[model samples]
Target: MILLRLTWLSLLNRKATLLLILASISISVFLLLAVDMVRHQVKDSFSSTVSGTDLVVGARSGQINLLLYSVFRIGNATNNISWQSYQEISKHPKVDWSIPLSLGDSHKGYRVLGTSQTYFTHYRYGKKQNLDFAKGKPFAGLFDVVLGAEVAKALNYKLGDSIVIAHGMGNAALVEHGDKPFVVSGILKPTGTPVDRTLHVSLEAIEAIHVDWKAGTKIPGLNISAEQALGMDLKPKQITAFMLGLKSRLSVFHLQRSINNYRSEPLQAILPGLALQELWQMFSLAEKALMFVSALVALSSFIGLLALMLTSLNERRREMAILRSVGARPMHILLLLVIESSLLTCLSVLFGVALLYLSLGTLSPWIQSEWGFRLIVQPLTLWQWQLLGILMLAGSCVGVIPGIRAYKQSLIDGMAIRL
Candidate 1:
């Protein structure tokens, strides 16, 4: 008890240096925790982007490519599956529901997805959470469109607002469908996934927009009014891809094999969970790099703490004499330094945790919108607790250097004032 009281007094006397050491350790610990927590949350967010769907069926292509373009709204399809085949497959006794996706158009820079009302009613994400509307209802007309939360907010669009679609999938488009405008019928709630950046419309709308175009170019002098186009048959001949949910999980493998061996078209079916695992394997290298940098930061912080203690040792020679005069043993002085360092490390870790939660509370929404990562603030994981224990042990080991030097000086300058 006497040793701890004296150590507290010593730290209080040098409060400025103590605080500098505290800040250094706190910032380093903060970086370490943030890197680990954000990495895990991002992985979780990405994996949860598509759920409750057993397989993603698309034209023959690489599994990763199909998963990217179909679920993530990235890249383009090499070929499209015939709508006739889609209808036959959706009618399979094992199939519970199917959502067809026809993607080729863009609005501003966001991808426009041509789907059916089944999308709003059956599609799900993030642990089977169904799509919810922030305002208005699903599209009820051929010219009606539903905007994702990010699309509505980015363009400041409200219900009943009209917008034109471009004929390509990027900032620059070859042609514009300015003749047929879509009215925003609904705005979906924020999803923190690719869905938030998409525009949804009926498949008929997609066919109507391209009625007068051939090979992606408008036919010269071929003008079709929106009303006239709507009157014509709008049955989609082909679609980029479709998602399937199985009535029984046991039938997933059989359906996947059936789709791969279909005689009508060259197609591929991928299990979303397995594909997601493969995708994360590709990102493991980046995760290791982040952990390596955090380790280095922690090491640097401990080195700075060592230097501060060593510098303070030079000015404490008189204090060492006072301790020896009062019958204090060299080992006691060494133990005091170790305990002080351990206390500082504990306090700094607490401060770092407090700062981490504060930052997450303030910036989580922005992070979700910008990066599609939903960070959940929660207690430290088991691994984090283990890492904190290792840090405390390392700090005590580093503290021993100055502690040994203090012990040596106390023996040589016993009862004698060096200054």
Candidate 2:
């Protein structure tokens, strides 16, 4: 109890230097905790991007490629599946429901997905959570569109607003479908996935926009009005990809195999869960790299604490003489230094934890709005508690160096000071 009181008083005496060291250690702790939290949250977000869909079927291509374009909206499809092929497989005995996706257009910088109303009913994300509207209802008209939360917020769009989609997948497109403008019929609530960044439209709307175009360009002297195009057939001939929910979990593999071996068209079907696992494997190295960097930061802060103690020891020689004159033993001085170091570490950890939660509370909403994923405020995980324990042990070990120095110096400089 005496040593602890003395340590606290000593730390308070050198407030400036000690506070600086405290800030450094606290910052390191914050980085370590933040990295772990983000890694897990990002993995959860990726895994739950689309749920309840057993298989994602697309034209013959790499599983990663199909998953990327179909679910993540990351890349363009290599080939589109014929509409006939979709119908044939969707009617399979095991298939319960299907959501067809037609990509290849953009509104501003966000991807425009052409899908059926079945998409709104069948698509699931984040533990089978259904899509909900933040503003209005789903599109009913051929020229109606529904905006994702991010798209609406970023573009400041509201219900009944008109927007034109551009050909291809970029913000800067040479051709715009200006003739057929779409009204904002709805805006979906944020799902913390790529769904938040997409604009939804009917599959027929995709075909209607290109009715007068041939070979990716509008035919010369052939301009089709939106009304005239609406009267013509708008059934999609092909689609980028489709997702399927099976009637039973047991039939998922069997149906996937059947679709992959379909004789009419070359197609590939992937289990969304397995494909997501593979995607995470590719990014595991990057996650480890981040953890490594955070560990180094923490290590450097401990090194700084060691240096502070060692440098302060010399100035405390007179103080040590006073204690020895009062019959203090070398072991007491050693234990004092250890207790002081432990106190510093504990206080730094407390400050770090407080800062971390404060920052999360302040920035969580902004992060969700900007990045589309909620920064979940959860209790420190067991692994995180273990990490804190390790940090405390490391800090205590660092004190041993200065403790040994003080122990040896007390013997030689008993009741005498060279200065």
Candidate 3:
């Protein structure tokens, strides 16, 4: 108890230097915890991007490539599957539901998706959560469109507003289907997935807009008015991919095998969950790199604490001599320094935790609105608790070096000081 009191008094006497050290340690702790939290949350978000779907079927391509273009809207498909293949496979007895996706169009940098009402009814994300409307209902007409939350907010669109889609994926598309403008019929709530950046339209609408185009350009001397195109056959001939939900979980592998062996055209079927795991594996190196960098920042802060104590040791020779005259032993001085380090570490951790929660609370809504993922605020996870324990142990160990030096100096100074 006496040693602890002496340690406290000594820290108070050097409060300015101690506070600076405390701030540095606290900020380091914040960075480490924040990085860890984001890493885990991002993985969870990615895994939950599409659920309740057993298989994603597309033309033969790399598993990761198909998954990226189909689920994440990250890239273009290598080839498109025939609409006839989709019908034959989706009718399989083992398949419960399927959602067709037709890509290759964009509206102001956001990808446009051509799908059916089945998409609105069967699509899910984040724990089997269904898509819900923020304003209006699903598209009921050929020229109607539904906007994702981010697309609506970013473009300032509302129900009944007209928007033209470009022929390709680029923002500055040279060829646009301006004649067949789509009216916004619905706006979906924030879903915290790639779905938030997409524009949904009926498959027929996709076919109608391209009726007058050939080979990625307008056909010479051909002009199909929107009303005239609506009267013509608009059945889609090909689609980028389709998602399937099985009637029975046991039938997933059977259906996957059958799709892969289809006799008509080359095709590939992938389990969404397994594909996601493979995708995460590709990114594991970057995640580890980030964690290592944050850890180094924390270690550097502890080194700063060590330097502070060692530099202050020479100036405290007179104080040590006074302690010796008051019957304080060398062991007591060593223990005092260690206790001071432990206290600083604990205080800094507490401050860091407080700051982390405050930042999450303030920024979570904006993050969800802008980036399409929620930052859930919860108690420290078990891994975080273990990390704190390791930090405390490390801090105490750091103090040992300066403590030994102080112990030896106290012995040399003895009970009297010449100064």
Q: Which has the greatest TM-score?
A: 2
- The digit string of per-residue lDDT tens for model 2 on 190-266 reads 89889899999999999999998886788899889999988999989999999999999999889989988999989
Q: Tens-digit lDDT track for model 1 on 1-419?
A: 99889988998999998898899898888888989999888878778788899999999998988998999888999999999999999999999999999999999988999999888878989989999999999999999999989889988999989999999888863578999999999999998888989999999999999999988899999999899997999999999999999999999999999999999989999998998888888989988998999899989999999998899887988887788888888888898888888888988888888888888998987886666566888989999888888888988988799999988887777778554
TM-score of each: 0.91, 0.94, 0.93
Clashes per model (N, Cα, C within 3 A): 0, 0, 1
* Candidate 3 residue lDDT tens string, 1-419: 88878888999999999999999999899988999998898888888889999999999999999998999898899999999999999999998999999999999988999999999999999899999999999999999999998999988999999999998997673578899999999999988888989999999999999998887788999999998997898999999999999989998898899999999999999998899889888889998998899899999999999999899888888888888888889987788889989889999999988888998899987887656677889888999999989899999998899889989888777876544
Q: What global local distance difference test value does model 3 have?
A: 0.91
Model 2 regions more than 4 Å off: 362-371
Residue-level lDDT for 147 in candidate 3: 97
**Per-model CA lDDT versus the true structure:** 0.90, 0.91, 0.91
Q: TM-score: which is higher, 1 or 3?
A: 3
Model 3 residue-pair collision total: 1
Model 3 regions more than 4 Å off: 1-9, 361-371
Candidate 2, number of clashes: 0
RMSD of each: 2.4, 1.9, 2.2
Question: Residue 344 deviation, candidate 3, in Å?
Answer: 2.2
